[model samples]
Target: MKCNKFLKGISLSVVWITLSICSVSANENAAEVWRFGLEEIEGSVQDIYAQAFKRKIEDKSQGEIVVEIYSYGMLGESEDLTNLTANGTLQLTHASVGILGAQIPEAQVFTIPYLFSNNDDHNQAVLANNPAIYEILGNALIDQDLRLMTLYLEGDMVWSTNKLIRKPSDFAQFKMRVMNSSLVIKTFELLGATAIPMPYSQVYGSLQAHIVNGQTNPIFSIEEMKFYEVTEYLIWAGQQKFTTSVLANQAWYLALPAPHKLILNETIEELTPYIFEQQIALNNTQLAAIKKSKPSMALIRLTKKEQALFKTISTPIRQQFIQNSGQPGQRLLEALDKALATEK
Candidate 1:
């Protein structure tokens, strides 16, 4: 009886040790989740691209890495998410170049008017395939504790107003909502408008309340935000072209294993073309749909000469951006121009 009791105790001890070992191994093999944040609504281009990224990462990583997305300001607004990404609290985020400029001013290079004639031109000039321009912009935020993963041209920006704005003087005395960007603000002011900087989330209510008479954004944004509801005119002024970037927390990205980093970079390169195509398609479709659905709303397109006049008016603003952007900003602008020239 004594021998049997002693053996039973030993067996129980062995079982406990085995269970502990298994627990440790299981913890070691568990996947690491990379969280992504998007300020846009679900089914929006931002959300769609994010979901695709999450899927690609998971499938390519074979369950070793998991990508979790928080869309529609789930994690936070652009500013909050930018802080989270910089401080390494969040793994990744997507934001407009203008929004990212608040964190890394060098990103404003893309806001230069006529940087590309259209989305296709912008894609060909500054996408993952073109390392010359891509690397400069991508690495611009490394010092800010964030790293740019990729860039997509959102679309051409247009002015939507309650009053028709056919010329630069037409913008005078009118309140125009703009992103919290000095370059954008300066652009509106140069065109003779009162530039009111506001967060995108507040734009609709502000329009309703007449806090601002008008705002500028891509066709997709104008439609998505339903600006036509409160406004009477959509002006295709093509004042500024908008581009957005995917950014990763520098610390988190640097800490990734070599294989993991390879997987991420490859996945981004593979998926960039699709995202760009989708953006172009959505912009075209929404532009047409908005015009159709809001037939009562005026859809105004400036003649080439008229657009040239606006560009001439904006030259000073461009200079202001270059001067304010500092030496690196100058270099980036030059590099971008060089790339564009080469493409031409």
Candidate 2:
């Protein structure tokens, strides 16, 4: 009987060992999941892009890749998301140059007011994927342990203010909410407003509570955040374009299997034009919604002369950016200029 019991135990041990081996093999071949984060909520350009990317990646990989999305504040603020991505805690994130500026100082060049022309072709055709520009920005990002997947625009930034602000002088009495970036603060300060550096998440409350009289963002942001309800003016001065960089954890990206890497590159290229069109549609629809909801709110588009006045003061900030970012920042600016000039 004792011999029979020992034999039964050995049989059970073999069964357990076989199960363990199979489990390990299944896990090895299981689908890989990627986390994609957005700095804006649903319906924003970032959200649209991420959704398209998620679909394409999953489809192309035939279930080998899966994407889980986190949109605005789900994983914390913009800077936090970038940190998570850089450290490999988050696989990917969408962030503005200002958010990236904290870690990648050279990225501050994009925060320079009027840096790109107020033309779609200039922004989309040239600046979006400019080899000269990304080559410099890419090196800067790699040092920060981030990879630039793509650069995209939400829309032209407009001021949601309590009053009309057509010229720099008109900003005399304004308290403008700017991102927590020195360049952005300096840009608004140069424009004659008392720039208050704050997190993007806090801007709505600040505006509603009168902590700040105004903030600058794309038309979709004003509508999405319902800023138009509190602010009395929508001033389109074209101070800057809201360019967001899609980033990946550099080390993780480098380690991706060759096919996975190919899938990502192909996916981004496929969605580029669609993403641009969606931004335009969102801005147009949202702007109309804001005006229809608040007929009393003024929609102020600055005349060329009025915009030029603000642009002139903005020039000094470019020199300031070069000083802050040093040689690399200077290169990025030069690259951007070369691309824009080439396009022109």
Candidate 3:
């Protein structure tokens, strides 16, 4: 009996040791693989953020966490990536507010044209200091099972067309490809273009086949998408600005070890400005490159008066957006206005 008791005690000790080892191994494995997705082409803003994220996470985690980036719709389209992240199929993703807004209506506030008079105002409204703004926007995302990691600027929207767009009248009858955002569609409609909502991947084919005569994007996207090849005109309208939100699957993020979660949040905080600066630098370079490569492409430079005229025409569209988006839209506009007022 004494011998059997001793043997049982030894067996229990061994089992406990094995279980502890298994727990440690599981945690180590969890820290090793961090997967992320982006819809942008490689080297674009999305790509830049993904690369920055990988570098920072790996450096901070000391190789304990490795980040894998999938770009150019590798895992799926923009909408698919958004849904996957929401459902925890993907760990992380970067999506334009326009796409994310479709899932969380409150996000539409970022899509409001001219709501931000310039880049400085937009940045001020969304940063960490603005708790009211962040709280509202962040909660909207949280409700959708996504955590808003960071808001990164994608620059102002500009026009690209096979025909010149020097004036509002120039866009008349032009079939312009726009994201499937109601505000975007309304904005283009106000500008006199036949706004055709399509995915970014479809823009190229539509332009190539003359199914769409024009599209709008920041200059970096024009270069990245090779819009110059399909279009003969580039316009610097700066009609609207856009920002992308880096999001993580809330469940997946919460599942991470405390240290790993801290590392991810810290890495994103460090990477936001870095990625935005890179985007600005790239946009400048792309603008120069596009000018050099397609010298014949007409460049439409709008005068202040003409831009004002365009804004005047877009007022009703803005009103419609606010009305359609309801109280959430009002709250966003109020927050933006408050941010802008502080600048003065």
RMSD of each: 12.5, 11.5, 11.4
Writing each residue's lDDT as its tens digit, candidate 1 over 27-108 gives 6547887878786877678887988999999998999997868776455456666665665546888878887676566777
Report lDDT (Cα) of residue 248, candidate 3. Answer: 87
Q: Estimate, for each residue in 164-247, the C-alpha lDDT of model 2 and write its tens digit.
A: 787788889789998888999988888899999887888889999999999989999999999999899888887788888889
Error of 2 at 148 (Å): 0.9
Clash tally, candidates in order:
0, 0, 0
In the predicted model 1, the residue pairs found to clash are none
- The lDDT of each candidate is 0.76, 0.82, 0.76
Q: For residues 21-98, what per-residue lDDT tens digits would candidate 3 score against the true structure? A: 346546755467666888798988888879878888888888787787878656556776676566554689888888
The TM-score obtained by model 3 is 0.87
Better of 2 and 3 by TM-score: 2
Model 3 spans with C-alpha error above 4 angstroms? 1-31, 119-129, 342-344
**Could you give the candidate ranking by lDDT, starting with the highest?**
2, 1, 3
Clashing pairs in 2: none
